[model samples]
Every structure is written in C-alpha cells, then in structure tokens.
Target chain A: MDRQRFDYLLEAYGADFARWPDGEREAAAAFAAAHAAELTEVLQAARALDAALGTRRVEAPTPDLLSARILAAHKRQRGAGLDWRAAAALAACAVFGVALGYGGGLLAPVADDGDYFASAFETPFADYDGDEG
Target chain B: MIDPDADLVRSAGAGDAQAASALVRRHLPRMVALGRRMLNDAAEAEDVAQEVFLRVWREAPRWKPGAAKFETWMHRVALNLCYDRLRRRREKSDPDAGLYVADGAASAGDAWLARQRVAKVGAALAQLPERQRSAIELVHFQELTNIAAAETLEISVEALESLLARGRRALKAALADVAQDLIGDADGVPRV
Candidate 1:
C-alpha cells in the first residue's frame, strides 16, 4: 500500500491491524514497520483516539425476564402455527371423506328398479298364495 | 457464504426450543449492545432487542439464507428499529431524550470516575451524525469486518471507510482531553 492509502486506512481503522481489512492488514503492518519513525505521531494519535473511544463501556447483559419474554413469544407463535396446521389437516380429512363417499356411490353397480320392486312383491305374494292353496 | 446460524434458524423455525434458546443466547447480548450504543438508554436498548427478536421469530419460519447472514440481517433490523425510535424522538423533540442517567447507588472512587469517563465518551459519540456514529459503532465497537459493516449499512466498502475516517476524526477532536487522560494517568500508568 502507498502512503496515502495507508494513511487513509489508519485514519479509518486506527492502530489495530485486526480492525483493518483482511487483505491489507499484512501490507499495512509492513508499511507501519518500514515507516515507524515517520508514522509514529499519527499512530499514537489514532491509538489515543481508540483508547478514548474505548472508555464507553457498553454493558448489555441480557436479563432473564427479557429472554423469557422473547422465548414466550416464540412459543406463542409456534402454538398458533400448530393450530393452523391442525385446522388444515382436519379440513383435508373432511374433504377426503366426502370424496370417498361420492366415489364409492359412483362405482357401485346399477340395478333395474322396476324389476326389483316387482320381484319383491312377487316373492311375497307367491309365498302367501302357496300357503293358501 | 456459510451461514453459521442457518441450521439454528432452520431448527428454530421448526419449533426447536433448544435451537431457539441457542439463537437467543448467541445474539441477544450483541443486539442489546448495539441498541445501547445507538440509543444510549438501557431500557430502550432492551426494548429494541426484544422487538428485533420478535421480528426474528416471525421471520424465522421463512428465513432463507440469502445474500446476508442471519446475524448481519439482525444488526440491520436492530439498527433500523433504533433509527425509527430516534426519528420519533426527533419528532417529539424531548429535551431530556437520549440522556444517560447515572445510577444513584454508584459508590465513590474509581468506579465513579470510570462512570464519568464513560459518560463523557458517550456524550462525544452522541455529537456525531447518525451515519458516522453508526459506522464507528459497527466497525470499531461491534468488531464487524469492513465488508460486513458495509453490507450492514447497505453502503459500498469505500463509502464505509470514508464514514469511519470522518467519524474517527470527529471523535478524536471531541475526545482529545479525555484521550490524554486515558492514555496515561497521573502515576504514568496506562489506563486504557
């Protein structure tokens, strides 16, 4: 990296090579080593700024209540999801039952209604007449 | 990209309690940290974290590992939520909004001094423009890679670097005195 790029990165990322772009960390470190005397002031200034900024301690401990609340929401969501799925499954079963009934009726053998009715009467009448005779 | 959170997200989506808890364990603190930095209020930061996770639960079922990782998406969501809150505060124009309240029970000595220093740094950070502050927060504080930070901010890498530089420059000027104090105390002990 050139002086201008190195300076630019140093300004942006500070003295921590870890914060620098991965590809340029080696080059930036090498440049700093090669030009330590010239870059000392700027590096020190960046370090100071880094140190100053570091003073703001962000202590964000996740409270148990918050975690419980979030997980409870997830549970509620999962419950709602389960209810929807169950409803869909029940509706599917109803549809399948109706379809099965209709299909079975359609597939049943047809019969001659008049002949059947007459045969029913004839058999009973014949039995009565034979008994009377 | 190999998303570390992909499996957890998928399992959580399918109602895996362990996975859901694991996801929360991994990301809740960071989300809270981001919100704390952006909003400067612990309660509000917690609210933001809750809101972000609620959105996560909603989207988890449909979360597709796309261009961004889950964590990156989460940071974006947290930031947007913070932005929304910030905008509302601006609209309300509350004079006391976003001010850090010192704990009454804080004991004296180094603890109090450290709290003061923290407040000073926070105040200096508050002076920066939102984008610049966000750039510094993401890269420096969150320790996100430059590429990831740029993606989180939805800006080009070059633009992200520019923002970082500008932010750092402004912070250097603002926190000069504090920096000196922090660099070396009266006893010449480095107190970073």
Candidate 2:
C-alpha cells in the first residue's frame, strides 16, 4: 500500500494516540479493512503493546493531607497577602497625613462664608478703611 | 481535562494552601499513573508525579494560555519527569531500565492484542530502547494521535512513525516464540 494510504490506515486502525477526530478515524478504519492482510502482522504487534500497557490507576492523596497542604500554603499566602495589604494601607495613610498637614483644606470646605470674608478683607474698601483709621 | 477552578492553579502557584490541595487532588491520579508507567516503581513514580505537579503549581503564574494548551504543557512536564526518572532508575542500576510490569489487559480493550499469550513480548519490550518504549506506550496504551504523541516526545511525526515501524518489526520477531504457545493444537486452527 502507498505510504499515504498506509498512514491513513494506521490512523484508521488506531495507534496509541490520546485522541483523534471522528471523520479521520472512520477513514482510517475503512483503509485498514481493505488492507487487512498487508497490515496484519504490524497491527498484531501494535495490539499486543496496547494490551500490555494497562491503566493501573493509583490512589490520590487523602483529603486531609490535601487540605493540610493546601491550608498550609493558603496560610502562608494569607500571611503574605496581609503583609501586602498592611503595606498598602500604611502607604495610603502616610499620603493622607501629608495631604492634611501640607496640602491645606484637606477636607472640602464645610462653611460657605469663610471664603467670602477672606476675599472681602483683600478688597479696596477694606484697604481704604484700614488707611483712614 | 482541566480543573474547572483554575483559580487554584493561580493561588497554588503563588503559595496558597487550599489551592495547593485542590491542584493536587485535580492532578495526582493521572500524574501518578504516568509516573508509575514511566518509572515502573510505584513509590518512585508517585514521587515524580508529586514533583511534576509541584513544578506545575510553581509555573502557574507564568502560564501563557494561548501559547500552547495547559494540559499539553503538563504532558510535556510529565514526559520530562518520566525521562528524569528513567535516568535516575538507570543510575541506580535497576534491571530492565525501569519498564513497568506487563499488566494483563484484554484484547477487546481498545482492540488491544492480548499479551497473555505472548511472554516474549514483554521481554522484547524490556529490551527495546526507551524511545521505542515511549512511542509504543503513548500510541498503544495512551492512544494518542501520532502528531500529539510526537509533540509529547518533542519529536517529529515522521520520526515517530520510523520509531514505531522499527519497534513493530522487532516485536513481531521477538514474539515469534509465542506462536507455538498460542497455537499449541493447531490441527483445527487455521494456519497462516
């Protein structure tokens, strides 16, 4: 058989591939049925291998162990997160303190009248009164 | 299949506890099986599997989703673990280069040709090179597509075919002895 056809047949008969598309699988199977004899010996060999490598499933770690490990790592991570959050919070507080001390009017103006008096004191009328007095 | 909550992968990568357990639970069995087959020693395989997952957890932060599949990458990681375990097995001078047992599997299973009748098959397998063994294992046992299996081995598909052909021919010749054992009373049975 031609290499291309044979390759198709191999795919059809199946190799130890983890997954394959359906249409391709069907095509391969058809090719193999037609060329059974020519492919027999090799197919048998492959089959034997397939049989020998069985899926002997093993045990996973128990939940407690899993949880302990997870929690341990979680705790460590939590601690790390706390540290980061603390650092960020401290930085934010420091910035706020600086703004309050030096930025002036750290809070929005609560009284509307304060600015009016301050502006009025600087006006020409106030200057004239102060000079006359 | 991936963990539904890949958040575990992220947290575990960054050293989260519950995430670590979840990651372990999600991956341990498959990894163990891979390790078991690769190293052929259950304990050793378990250790390798543990190490593989640990590395995966460590690598979670660097995972590039589109570059390649996360599972394919994991398979590659498992393959590397297997290779490392193979080397470690050889270093200690264990017999058969650490190939796993020829567990009896049904011929009907995945259309597997039964090894129950072919004792020489296992021996021949043990005698084959590790590359050949991996090629066989992935294709026959794991049932991976040629291209995918090749990727797992970091080899080209043509190279995989070459290895398989060579391996098959060797198996046929090696298993010839079992011909007698299989057809003890061949009088009625059709002859080739």
Per residue, candidate 1 scores C-alpha lDDT tens digits across B50-156 of: 99989999999999997799988988999899888987774222322343434446567666676667777777777788899889989998899999999999999
TM-scores for every candidate against the unseen true structure: 0.81, 0.58
Q: Candidate 1 — what's its lDDT?
A: 0.85
True contacts kept of each: 0.76, 0.11
Q: Highest TM-score, which number?
A: 1
- Scored against the true structure, residue A90 in model 1 reaches a CA lDDT of 98
Off by over 4 Å in 2: A1-4, A7-24, A35-42, A55-133, B1-26, B89-126, B171-192
What are the per-residue Cα lDDT tens digits for candidate 2 across A14-39?
A: 45322334436565566668887887
**Each model's backbone clash number:** 0, 19
lDDT value, residue B147 of candidate 1: 90
Against the native complex, each candidate's DockQ, computed on alpha carbons, is 0.41, 0.08
Q: Whose DockQ is greatest here?
A: 1
Instruction: Place model 2 in a CAPRI quality band.
Output: incorrect
